[model samples]
Target: MEDSRDPQFASLSVGDSAVAVLVDRATDDADVIHDIELMTCSEYSHLCLGMPSDDTGDLAMYTNNKEMHAEDRLALWPAFHRDRLAADGRRFADEGYDFVVQHQVGSRFVDYMNHVGESTFGTPMPESLSVVEKFANTATTSHYLVLHQALMERRIPRGSKILMVPAASGVVTGFLSATVSSLEV
Candidate 1:
């Protein structure tokens, strides 16, 4: 286990963005609830935070006026991109991030976002598509897990700029950009 008092860990909190400590289950042992991985993130310098201008009105569309169905919501996803995600793509470019880590709701969603991203940014946004395809599941930790996977694979070079757009229930979306530090896994 890493100590929060350590300089390396403490340094993560110096950035403008809020620090997050991600804990994920690392073992299958029935008696080992304590066996886990602790990821101390927030090493990057904050660049920007973005949210949709019209959340309440937009949320209704996602919920289909409070009558949301899984299939209906999935079908409506393509239209949803025209709103916040499209705007965020421009923001991603304006903020000068080297790459983007989109919310991995599904493989199809990621691919669709990439397609939309190409149109919005005039070039394909580099993202971890393979991670989403391989994982094949959605979790709140998807972005963090994807980042950790990329870092572990050395795919994201040190000091590279990164943008993350994560969406959630109630039709909320968030855009966070930062410069990567020399964080070790």
Candidate 2:
């Protein structure tokens, strides 16, 4: 399989809207592959075909996965979360993104992660927290849903730079950066 992080996979231009789909599990079963393709098409067909050509949005996506040494996933959450944020989170901030749509696994976890992010990035709490706080616990789809909510609410202005960090059980993390556009769902 091709690495989604490769520039060739995400060769987005200024006006392009990109979608990043990261599958942590790989299977050679034809049925499974068919199902995955069907799901992707069904879920994102609108974004792929309905977005206005004139909308000048910029999007970039990258995913990171740390090899697990411990059997218990929860045991490594804090360290993995903190370390990834310290590295990529700061880089994103330095690049001048408007805000991050952080994964809201839980209220306390989100707060803890935000504090860690602030300390690591040497910045105050981001305005994106409003979305996190509003929608308390969206498990796997926090990043995408939160971003959509923010865009729908007009909290993020057109052309604003945005970052989204979505993490999962395997310590899989994705960094998606996008520029807001006039395209509406």
Cα lDDT of model 2 by residue, 87-106, tens digit: 65434245556776667755
Supply the global lDDT for candidate 2. Answer: 0.47
**Where's the lowest-lDDT run of ten residues in candidate 1?**
31-40
RMSD over all Cα atoms, model 2: 18.6
Task: Work out the TM-score per prediction.
Answer: 0.50, 0.48
**What clash pairs does model 1 have?**
none
Model 1 spans > 4 angstroms off: 1-94, 128-130
Model-by-model lDDT, in order? 0.48, 0.47
